[model samples]
Target: MVNDVLAIHNGNYSWNIAFERGLQDLELDDYALLLTSLHEVHIKVGEDDRSKWKSGRDGIYSVCTYLRSILGSTESSFPWKMTLTVDNLHRKGFYVTEWCYMCKRDGETNDHLFLHCEGVRWLWNTILTSQHMDWVMPRRMEDVLRAWSRKFRDKDSGLVWNLFPGCIVWCVWRERNIRCFEDQAKTTEQIREWFYMTLYT
Candidate 1:
């Protein structure tokens, strides 16, 4: 799974410390909201899978495929940006509408990629007890993010596990941009590798 590969989003030094420090500012309701919406079960893995940790992590990568997005109602996936959909709205307005690059659903936007990408289905499975997450994919990214946050909210709870999801999402979007404008592309492996590089070091 991606978490096993590029496991941390490290662009911002002290990011973990900062995030933890800010936790105190949250009210009990914020914590409750966070937990209620957290989809922690989406990452459950079989006990047998413990052995394939590294392999699972590496499989989350796309080593040879070019990062490309199919044409849609929007002009291009260049200006595309995905942010926390805390209240059921993307950071920007949906111009024409889009579908997830990996899922090929009716609507391919930030939420789809975050919560429903089959590309990351294996990764999500690591959190769910069922050993498969895509089967019962959440309706939106906000739910996934909050669920992830709540599940790993504890300091001793491996909350850093969130880095994998956040980094993959960011890297995928970055690759889409590079492909659209620079006419450049990277294999999924390269993207996964770069995700680790850009996010951590």
Candidate 2:
């Protein structure tokens, strides 16, 4: 509820003379363009104020934005944060069974849950075959991405190819969570329908 929190007065932003003089003392007068972005934003009365983080595309904050601000973009690809597995939980000090919550056979991992689980294999194979693609499932998530990048060529086909893997991964993770946390289960067909609704809508 502070009016001058951002040094903005009467909804107008201007450099304080003392701060400008300090900047002059620091030999930073050449960086005066930093305050050029402080334009006025109109607030609509009777509307509840909503917080937004401006760094992300949708005006929502993400850890990626915070990391990039600090490290200045190393251009490193980060693993998907949305995918959760029992192994990850175990690593984080949770007492989860060290197996996939979906298949419950092999040890859970990002690679195993998304790529190598038998249930995931069935889901991927069925989806790919419906698209008239007979792809051999890759051993690792990175390999899956590499194979996907090499398989599709045309723009339309490329979009489907790009979104399909992510959709599948998301659906599988959702199903796993439902079974784990909610004690509810969904069949592959239900998952397929959810997948289409997710991407098409």
Candidate 3:
């Protein structure tokens, strides 16, 4: 699968394909991590394929090493050092349009695009109404997540409820990209349907 997306270019592995859809914030971070991890990998011609456990000193697999590799050596951070939001792009000296693509009424920021835009608010309200839950949206995305986490603790609905915010944000972001880059927009109903489809599957 990796070979399908990568190619040996000038004796070094390079990405040879483009993603079908724009990557989300977290997905972009993961992609960065992947590239970082692969930076040192060298391909040797005429060599047999063999598995080596890099986590162990002897390149041998062990239970402790395996567990440590999976658990990691330190607490993971959000890795939000940078984002692709218009505000961030402006900070990076890219002079793109400042207005929000979805609503076009406010400057585009991470919070406004994902949570606070007029259209985004309507989508959030629709989700809450479907669950018969009333919520006062917070000023920040972190606060909204904190509030949602506190409300749902049950085993069944809680899991789906916990996933709802992420699902909504992802769907909204994809729609935003479609409108910005492709000059195409999906109706609120279409966005809602896309969110539900993404959440369940």
Best by lDDT: 3
* Model 2, position 152: C-alpha lDDT score: 56
Q: For model 1, how does the per-residue alpha-carbon lDDT over 77-125 read when each residue is reduced to its tens digit?
A: 2223324222223444434334444444545556555556665454455
Clash pairs for candidate 3: none
lDDT (Cα, tens digit) per residue for candidate 3, span 1-201: 766876766665676657899889879888888777776676674466688899999999998677677556633222122447798788778998779989988998878877899979998988889888798888877677666764545787878988888888788878988898999999878887888899999
Q: How high is the CA lDDT of each candidate model? A: 0.48, 0.70, 0.78
Error in Å for residue 53 of model 3: 12
Candidate 1: where are CA atoms >4 Å away? 1-107, 119-136, 150-159
- Compute the lDDT for candidate 2: 0.70
Cα lDDT for residue 105, candidate 3: 85
Pairwise TM-score winner, candidates 1 and 3:
3
Give the poorly placed runs of model 2, Cα more than 4 Å off.
1-63, 67-78, 150-154
Rank candidates by TM-score, best first: 3, 2, 1
lDDT per residue as tens, model 2, 1-201: 423434555655444434434455455654454444333344443457887876777888898886665556553343543345666666667876777777878998998888888877887877778888787777678677766764556787778767878788778878888988898888878877888888676
